[model samples]
Target: MRHTVTMSPDSLWGLPQIRAVCLMAFAGISSFAVMLAALPVWGVGHAVPAHLAGTITTVMLAATVLTQVVSPALMRRFSLRGLLVWGLVLLGLPAPLYLWATALPGLYAVSAVRGVGFGLLTVTAALAIQVAAPPGRQGEAIGLFGLAGAIPTMIGAAIGAGLTLSGNFGWVCVIAATPLLGLAAARGVTADGTAPGGAGESLPMRIALRRLVVPVVLLFAATAAGGAVITVVPLELTGSARAALVLLVFGAVTAYARWRIGRFTDRRGHRLVPQTLTVIGAAGMAVAGWGFAAASVPLLLAGAIGTGIAYGALQSVTLDLAFSRVPAGQAPIASATWNAFFDAGTATGAAVFAAVAAGSAGGAGSMLVGTGLFLLVGLATVRSALAPWLERRRGPGRMEP
Candidate 1:
């Protein structure tokens, strides 16, 4: 059996493929961040029913899932650069539609189009990172890829929210511009000489199911915490500025944590990262819960920072673990499957938390309970699942490279 060799850190960083991966991350994540920021504004400007706002987000997520199912096949047919550029174009062209969207159906259609574009961007970017990364460094590579969005998400959300506060939809156009920039970045990425592998083999539904269950459950719990924040927190708070500040702080802290953890995972391993993060996350949730209960602004901000860090690292770690178990050729599918869990978690979290908040469990009570769940069952299970994998990576005969 011929083993593939891993690249040294220096070589990995020098590769154009790696640079491409970072660019795609920046572009893809920024686009989504802008959309998230603009959605609430569009909802209010158009008199969108409050109850239906969640549904709009659901539409985009649903479309993303549907498109992701076929993304691997699409990559097989097109070069990464081709897929990325087209995806960016698709993502960019749809924002103007928001200006004319007068009804729920139109808004949902816009979201669906953007979602499809996002789906394409995500899968291609995942594949790009896999091809670019050194063996044994997949965790770090993916973590860095995640930072692309994390940074832009923090910046774009702040800008979008600021523009929305001005009661202007023109900022949506500005947000769309980032995707075009991404298109230019995508063009610079040379297609790796390697062709797509595992062209015709379908991912067994049973196996994908078995592999995904635990990770999905944990991710769902965490995202539910996010959903509660995105949905219930804004509505419950008296001012949009304060609410936006909360979200901004959350994004910033999360991005920083992800960067640190990615570098840590590259050197240390995935297990320790998650274990440490989970403990910290648990404490953060406790603080957040306390803050919510007491309505303390300082405590709330601190909690948001902690939760953001944990959440950002969680997704990247999960993706690294999934890829570690799968063949290199199957990394894209593994990533897509992993992301599906994330999307499901987001949806489930939003739905469950919304119910709690609506039920007279005030927003504070709902957040406390939801975040508390993350600290307890969610973080605990994630740490437990990662233990065996960590042990294997450390064993004498099972060196990471």
Candidate 2:
């Protein structure tokens, strides 16, 4: 007989396991928020050159990618609760260090320390959620889990921007404290050793690579578009207020779309929803770029919303696709690998788009290039290149169990 796991709404609140997952999610995500909040402030405060800001971001993302590779092994050795709490402390306590970071060396040190913490927190939280979630509802649980990070990305950027406007270094410290809130939440929850059952068993790297290709490619495309906008939009607008508004709109739409897409994927499958969103996103980027070139505020806003929606949908859907194909025990590794792709895409997008926009043709030319890439990704999905391969590997008629 198959086991049936039912989780009540109130049960989620009362159960230590469920509560633990929520806490970790909140803590991990808040750490991410602090990082986003810190970047621009650090860039301006130290009078770092604009060309260097992208490199700084790349260093942090590179750290994340490296750490994510080893996260599964780390989780296997340490309890989830232990890893999360320690990671939170490492993430939170580094704020004071940032206050002292007046030089590039100091900033680099801070990035390395914080990057490790963020990387561990991300992987641990996802593992906790997957283990805590009752079977058959993993998709919804992961979706909700994702919001801890998504919501903050929107809020943190705005708050970070606001704090910067105050012309105070103290606000950066305050923002750094934000991750502690998650630590408090994590303290109330318990760790489960059984969460990652059978995870340490060796698997072929080739198999893992083949399974991850589709989601990684999709991630690359989405982040490239997002990266292009993030790099070029501000320069094109030439007004802090307008640039901030664009980011704010992008964050809000992305957050809502993430929540809705989670449920949609849980009911449907990952393949179709994301493919459709990619096409829409390409169009949105095209419109937004055109608007940026024409200086049309309304068109820019429309494009921002579309891009946000598409990003939100794609983020969760890609994770779902990975988890659906792998063993339940491998969720953490799967989640980490997926995030590494996201970070890589973001890093590449920032660097490449900035270079492209620096040319005589400017931001408009860069957007056009980004739009073409997104559309190509969309076409690949429509051709069923990834879906059929994944379906065949798992065999027919096997849905998430």
TM-score of 1: 0.85
| Backbone clashes, each candidate | 1, 0
Per-model RMSD to reference: 4.1, 3.8
lDDT of 2 by residue, 157-244 (tens): 5555555545555775676766677766765556556236464564566776667777778878887777666656654565557766
Residue pairs that clash (backbone atoms under 3 angstroms), model 1: 224-349
- Choose the strongest candidate by lDDT: 2
Q: Clashes in model 2: which pairs?
A: none
Candidate 1 regions with alpha-carbon error over 4 angstroms? 1-13, 192-195, 199-205, 350-355, 375-401
| Candidate 1 lDDT tens digits, 1-401 | 01334436474456677777688668766877766646755675688765555566677877877888887677767788887777787777787777787588888898889888877777777778877777666766777777776888777665665566566667656676577776656655776433357755545657655665555555566666665565555544556677678778988887876666655665656444555566666666667667767877788789787778777887677666666655556666776777666666666555556556556666666666765676665545654655566776787333221
lDDT of each: 0.67, 0.69
lDDT of 1 at 245: 83
Top candidate by TM-score: 2
Q: What global local distance difference test value does model 2 have?
A: 0.69
Candidate 2: where are CA atoms >4 Å away? 1-18, 34-38, 41-45, 194-203, 231-236, 358-361, 385-401
